[model samples]
Target chain A: MTRASRLYRSSLLVAFAALALTAGCGKKQAAPPPPPPPPPPPPAKPTVTLQAAPTTIEKGGSVTLSWSSTNATALVIQPAIGNVAPEGSTKVSPDATTTYTITATGPGGSIDATASVNVTQPPPPPPPPPQPTLEELFARDVHDAYFDFNKADIREDAKAALSKDADFIKAHAGIKVVIEGHCDERGSTEYNMALGDRRAAAVKKYLSSLGVPADSLTTVSYGKEKPSCTESTEDCWQKNRRGHPVLAK
Target chain B: MIRQPRTPRIALKLHWFFAALLLAASPALAQDWFRTGTGLGVERPRVAVADLVPRAPEATAHGKLFTEVVRGDLDFSGILELVSPSFHPLQSPGMPLQLNYKAWSDAPASAQMVAFGNLQESSSEAAIEAWLYDVRNPSSPPVVAKVYRGAPTDAQIRKFAHQFADEIIGKLSGGLPGVASTQIAFISNRTGSKELWVMDYDGANQHALTALRTISLMPRWSPDTSRIAFACYIQAFGILSPQICMFSLELGRPVTFPRFHGSNSAPAWSPDGSQLMFSSSMSGYPEIYSIDANGSHFKRLTFSAGDSASTSPAWNPKTGQSAAFISDRGGFPQLYLMNSDGTNIRKMDLPDMGYVIDPAWSPNGQLLAFSWRRPNGNFDIYVMDVTSHQIAEITRDAGRNERPSWAPDGRHIVFESTRGGSRQIWVMLADGSHAHALTQSGANESPNWSPR
Candidate 1:
């Protein structure tokens, strides 16, 4: 036979072989029929509802949770931190003042209400002033700074940290601060280092504005290095990408 | 009695005739025979001359040898733009021979070349003649300057073509040809394994230089064409650790650098080939570090908090006192230049284009070629005049054209692109013309041009 005819025959044979193989395998079973629908019956009734609970309650005090209901079945009370009340009941025990959520359910519908119990601790005697740890005091002279993503300007978070360092330096007139800038693991190393420096410098500028001596603070940038937290989470990254004050001896 | 004598004579004559036929068959039958068709046809008688004349060879342009020899010449010399036979319209099939002087004059091409050849019967052997034309002088007839004769195997054709093109370029440019005869070292993951591969500048004659088992990347060429350094990952204790390795073209063996904790990658060689600059997180962050060629004397160049300082260093050849690096010092990764001592740092004023990295210095130190992330998030190669600070985009529409390396002559740049659905090495004039894919299979990236 000619080459073309042979090829055509071979293809036909292959098709047949494939068909045979498929045929030898059984077909998939059909899905089961869906279940029948249920019949309709009961009528609904109007119900009163509590939108919210008391804004605050005294600490270590028991509070009663209540909600309006409709056609009756039961109500459920869930305390945020403690055990729920009796099945469908609204009373909860108290340890710490916490939020309690009350859900009232009947044949008609369900509704939720929440109440916050304020927990107050008894005033304690005033303690002695905090003595700065050696590391903290050492780092105090170093101006630490953090930056927002792709930014060198000091954010509120960075300012808070810098303010504390500034206060410590003002109290200890003899101490000098070195501002170290840091970055997250989002950019190349070189870019991050410059960014870190910018952060540190921004911190130093902020402190100097607050009457801190400019000559008392120095700035350096360690870009994306020495992360406070190594976990690849936003919270960790935020903490790591911050400037810190290290007291230069 | 007379009839019996006649019969005997006739029988004797018949026997003599048969003997003569057998002798003639013996001379012609000394040949190998094989069936040509299915058993449906009768066998035809034939003679075989197995030992007659030498075997006709398989034809090739001798691409490798051609590229090697041509690249050697260009390296030693300093010419750019090897005029290839394929580029000559007169030599191309179905192309008209009309010479356009204006077009040639406008082109950046330094020379024009022509080659013609015929393949032998076995299709392995070829006889080719080449001609070179000085585009600077369109009035002159083409010069029959050189003749290349060889029966190179099929694999050698591409090298031969490049070599011939380089020769023509040298004659026209008055220096050693640059990219035309050079090869690019790159990483290709076509075989499901990332390995270092070398190909001609135009992306032809691609072959794997490293073994298939390792995941190799960031291939950089030594000033000489003899070796390539790349980053490879080794699996140890259930973790894959990246390490730098050098592969010698001459030995076909890999010499891995010393092991270090964390990732070590982005290797660039000093102009003198004495040290290798790379980014390693060994000091707790990815910082620019240099090590001797034999992988000793590792020294950190930058110390910044957040451990972000320097990466992707392109050492300056002329001064050797400054290097261009990419840093996030501005909160976003941007290109920066710093003294070799990691001081005197300054940001490059790139155009409105942001996110520039991967700086490759031209051999002449007149320009810097780098890849920039475009607004569309696709990377494209761009060149900046060092003195004028003028920037121009070299490639567009080609998807992710990045990791550009300037050819030794500075007239051409080699880079990797994902334009053809798969990443492949591409070469174009430094001004972004004549873009073509050079690799056929596998995704290729991180192309580094050899110096010569």
Candidate 2:
């Protein structure tokens, strides 16, 4: 009975195989497949260039730092240049030989460029040309201007002396001078300091009006500390209250 | 100590009787007899400072110094006349238990209050048991009973004595602490440059505070006594720029540079400890300016420009309502007043003393002390009543007196003078009496008394 069943199963399988082959040979294609994507372009390379105008300078001199970058979102300079625009310039006064590096960063990554500034020590300035024997002459030219008791205003007679002094200062434009305001030993030290400052300021104002460079003039108040005369007499006090000029080297 | 050790009942009975006697005597004697020796219509309280009993014989020197300093401090307070040690009873008190209050309150000495202590010194430190007793209240406990220990150097002994004296004053004067323990900050040229220095109220323990080695001047202490602000010349922009700097005692360094654009000088702390008044030339001319404690919120107070300059502002300490400053708007430096906000400017009613400068308002806001120059060019310290404009001279014929600063107690003043052959810092009673040199070696000036 087993042999008879096996032969029947084999005949049915052959009939099903013929039916399946006829159905598959009649199927149709729907559409052609889409083309593959083009290979990705190489990542955009960020570029930067840093340049220093007058790359070599004497000590204490300044240089212009210029930078240009493309395909970058941010730019920065190191060694004190700090953050900078992608395309910009700045003035830098490097005290020493310094290599300034600029880094530009973007989605593509970071690119760096560097420029070095060489600071050369300036040669000694010819020993200052053997400073003239002008101390006594300058002292003679600058006379002490007097003031009244408890008064900071330039006395009427002091204008002549101050005018001559201003002329001398204008004659020697290179010389810097200090006007010391002194007070008689007749007031509080703290108050005298203020008084002294006022006197010196008055002298400075007068000198500036006379064409002396304000920058070349500075004032200090000696108050009652450096009295020209130590006596209690009016004459001594009159002498003590004076605005005297000092030469500043 | 009770001489009879075994008679317990008798001792109790005696104690009760003594207590009863004290309760009866204290009200009348204690109230009316309390005095500051100034004799300014007030009775001088009779107080006695006993020589400190030496627990260690070697500490006798320290004990002597302690007793002397305490006596001197009390005397200088102008509040009490010390009962001389010769007048102290034979049964001297080394401790509160041994205090013979009945004896101290009796006879010619009749000291209402007595200070007694025991001093023991080792090589490095001294242990002190200081006691102050209301001798009039024989049976009452000591008004002040405490132990103080510190280094036993001469300076330490003096400091402890000052503390003890201050304690006594606090107890006797309705809790008003005396200025015995305070310090005076002054400018000195001891190190070849005008620098800041500090000394105890009695002119002891003088020491240099800043080593800036530049021209430092006008040291003024903050109200909290934590910092000393002074004017110093600093090199900025290759030039000597005068700037106000502060030396912090707690930080042991200069905490403030206060670098305004121009010269800054004459720093004075506000009474509330919130701001400082300094003269600045930042506005192209020197004028009074106020800045906060941290050097922010700089506001100019005096608006005078050109030769009409104003500076040296002294803020009122009590109410912080007014300030006294020197201004030359009238062609001469004279005292001027304005509100703390730099408003309500007015001229002070000062006499024709030539020029008035360095106006320091008293702590109580009652008086303003300043240096007034006579026509003879002689500077003397004078005080004027803020309310009545009554002038009182604190120093006369004293070689160039200036920069009078009032102590926190409002009863004393410190100033700089050439009276002692050189410019030295001196402390005196508010009445200009008992002037004593607080600095000796160098030309010290501009004494700023601390608040505490």
Q: Which ten residues in a row have the lowest lDDT in candidate 2 chain A?
A: A30-39
Error of 1 at B392 (Å): 1.0
Chain A vs. true chain A, TM-score per model, equals 0.44, 0.47
Q: lDDT by residue for model 2 over A2-40, one digit each (tens)?
A: 565676667667766765666577566543343343344
List iRMS for all predictions: 9.2, 2.0
Report, to 2 decimal places, the DockQ of model 1: 0.05
lDDT of 1 by residue, B118-185 (tens): 32323444444444443445667654344445555644555555666565444434343535667788
Q: What is the lDDT of residue B337 in candidate 1?
A: 80
The residue-by-residue lDDT of candidate 2 on B69-186, one tens digit each, is 9999988876667898888897668978787777898987788888898999999899999998878777778788889899878878888889889988766655557889999988
CAPRI-wise, candidate 2 is acceptable
